[model samples]
Target chain A: MTTSDTSVLAPLADVDPADLARLHAGLEAAADRAGQLDIAYTTFDSPVGPLLLAATETGLLRVAYEIEGHDRVLETISARISPRILRAPKRLEGAMRELDEYFAGRRTTFDVPLDLGLSAGFRQLVQRQLAHIAYGHTQSYGQVAAAVGNPKAVRAVGTACARNPLPVVLPCHRVLKADGSLGGYAGGPATKAILLELESAA
Target chain B: MKTGKPPFEGVVAEHSATVLRVCRAVLGVDEADDAWSETFLAAMRAYPDLPADANLQAWLVTIAHRKAIDVTRARQRRALPVENVPEVATTVPAPGDQDDELWHALKALPDKQRHAVAYHHLGGLAYNEVAEILGGTTDAARRAAADGMKALRTSLMGSKGATR
Candidate 1:
């Protein structure tokens, strides 16, 4: 609907931008305090691109690349998890720090707690084994499938790695194709290459 | 569970400015911030149960309306006469201090007119939605907002014209 068409009322029509920002920050904090914030998220500028870090009170939930569409990912999280989400950067501080260290090459393993609610059954089992692949090491889809106790599920393993909700944190980039080619990645192929190079160089 | 609702953060990010302007118009700036925060906090709490197709801006304005009423009631209870009054000074406003004459004029409006203007004009809701919130017919809500704007123009512009 259009606002009232009166120039004398122009000043009343809009809120100061800075004041609106301050109000948003306050509301975010208030929501967090009241334990109503079901999911908290923030964006970080990473070497791969901007990463969307989101979490629930349970643990770190989803980390998305800009290519994945941050808005779409958030909608998915809202649908799959809960719609009570807020952009509160402070809640993701722990995961952010661990990722910061991982990208800096100073840390190999993620110590932050994770919420694997986005995946289930076979996919969850596949992601659980990804962290054991070692930092600079590579594992074939067949190998991961075998390791997860489904030796015949090689293609399934490939699908799991491709659909991994938490990519960098779960080390899906370490899983490669049987032909030694980077099969596919959620963050695109070039990003997978950058992550692989970052690990191998360290 | 529904599988297509957009994140509540999107709701907050998109409509917060409008909500703030609505609150400020209805309750004045000092009370507006608290009303805005309380409204969002309440909205977030009940968000999961909200229908996916719900009008988010109108929904938020509904919540803001309730919150503004609560704030107004609390302010009324806290209203007390001061023992000593400072001398009235006609000091010019400081650099960062907002010019509050317009806000004062808005607060002086009758409650129905103030609410109608805030909900329809600033909150961007249709007259029917404003009527729903204010408990009246759409035409009445429209008339109240129009009347409120007319009064504000007469007072604020008339004062400005007198000075010039």
Candidate 2:
């Protein structure tokens, strides 16, 4: 019950919060507002097509192929992860730059941190193993399955590759059919062929 | 009462306007974004530590008050290219003349009173909380805010008539 030092203050004038909201949205969309939105995403155009990169505070979340559709991809991830999503390009700068280098044939492996919350269980296990398949390298789906301690789960490995949340970043394109033929790819076989050719040419 | 922790985005949605009003009052509209950004950045970094029952608005405004001081100090050390900057380079639209007059008046008040008024009225903190931020007994903060209000009433009217 001590005496306080301030005088009675007048009510401040009403300000339009809409301006602040819009400003927040604008910042969250671009350079200023970083690490605030729960899920921040950006789109990058590569030789394959428009690639959608989404991230969480943990790290890079998803790298969606064009065939999956960026809007649909983002909507699905936002629902699964957190709904407070925004197009924060600043947060995706590292991924974009790395993708650029990869596409330019100057880089062999991805070095950015990844948020692998999209996949789990045996699929997650397979994805981690897939990441180690270096540039210009291809392993048969059965080979990848054996690497994950389930040599008989050849079809499971194929399923995992098809459902990869991060295709290009995790290098899931390196997995193919047992007969050395191009298997199914989430980004379409044509895109897979492009990636395989790029790696081989590199 | 739900004991669940609402997301940090919810905090931003709930309190951004109050924080903006506090910053605009203390730093004026031109530099308010600087304070706003710094405040939220700091808050987000420390959000995990915030108590579930904490007064979210007051906590944010306190961070904002500290950030405003930092901006002022940084501005002091930097060279003043402010006056010579071209209009086209500025992104934020200037406030309308009427709003501009109020800003001019608020900026004219003494720093402590302006801060006191902002923290108490705009930021919606109690006098005791304002005192903690302003570094005084609650009574002193009350006096400063009252004095600031008296000055604003005089200037808001005087400046309005004179600007015509």
Question: Among all windows of ten consecutive residues in candidate 2 chain B, which has the lowest summed lDDT?
Answer: B1-10
What is the C-alpha lDDT profile of model 1 across B109-163, one tens digit per residue? 8999989988887788899999999998999999999999888777777755733
**Best TM-score among the predictions, by candidate number:** 1
Candidate 2 lDDT for residue B9? 55
Which stretches of candidate 2 lie above 4 Å from their native place?
A: A1-22, A25-54, A57-114, A117-123, A126-202, B1-5, B79-96, B158-164
Clash list (residue pairs), candidate 1: none
Candidate 1 lDDT tens digits, A1-202: 4455566556766667898778878877888888888899999889899999999888889999999999999988888898888888998999889889989999999988899989999999999999899999999999999999999999899888988989899999999888899989999999999999999999
List iRMS for all predictions. Answer: 1.8, 6.7
Candidate 2 global TM-score: 0.54
- Encode model 2's per-residue lDDT on A32-103: one tens digit a residue: 345447787878999999998888878899988877977677667745675456566778999999999999
Per-residue C-alpha lDDT of model 2 across residues B28-128, encoded as one tens digit per residue: 77788888878877777676557778898889999999999999888766736556665334433255565565666677789999999899877878899
Residue B52, candidate 1: how far off, in angstroms? 2.4
